[model samples]
Target: MPTHHEDELDYTPTPHNVTRARTRTAHLAAAWGHPALAPDVALVTSELTTNAILHGSLRGRLIRVRLAVVDTTLRLEVSDPRAERVPHPREASPAEQFGRGLALVGALCDDWGHGPRDGVGKTVWAEWKLPG
Candidate 1:
């Protein structure tokens, strides 16, 4: 049986760091021999990190970007420092500029959810099942 493989990185909540997280996720997916999952993974990273920066970020706190592979499933987790700002998918108006990140995450991943961390903040995660 294949064992679970995972890695994580912490980043200050910033727009530039979101890009860095996305790039790192893409690179990791490829290095793990799942290049096909890179694009979607990158997109999910972008959405999650951006949401963190906008809603969950706090002073002196950092966001965590985590990637994991268990069996054929690939997981991406972004943990930010605001437990109060929970995320949910909602309809975005045509005139609105935001409010669709989770929707996009849902479209790209097989499963996604969020939960509070041990002390403060919360973790938003998405997972995709690799093609067998």
Candidate 2:
């Protein structure tokens, strides 16, 4: 039986923190009998964290990560303190500077979306189907 509580994993926005996030996700997946969901969750986490570090205000704000499993579906959300810059899927040329994170998220997860977080910043989320 999975615990039904509002669990949240929050951490600083550092490169090493990304690995920590991955490990945490792995543990959560294993506990919920959804080890296969770890990789996709890790990928999404990486993309979101990287975006926060590169484009958002990372002075003293910590990146908030929340993971939950409900009805055989795993929902992952990464929130940062920057609402001015919203993520959008866009076309990129072969020689483009940078632009392909959200695209990868769309391809990996069963469903993904982004929205404002309490009028402060945006939370990019993705969900994966758990194995039976």
Q: List the residue pairs that clash in candidate 1.
A: none
Model 1 TM-score relative to the real fold? 0.93
RMSD of 1: 1.5
TM-score of each: 0.93, 0.84
What is the C-alpha lDDT profile of model 1 across 37-67, one tens digit per residue?
8999999999999999999999889999999
Q: Which stretches of candidate 1 lie over 4 Å from their true place?
A: 1-3
lDDT of 2 by residue, 27-108 (tens): 7766767767777777887887777667765588877888887767788888888988778888788899789888888988
Give me the runs in candidate 2 sitting further than 4 Å from their true place: 1-6
Q: How accurate is candidate 2 locally (lDDT)?
A: 0.78
Q: Cα lDDT for residue 44, model 1?
A: 95
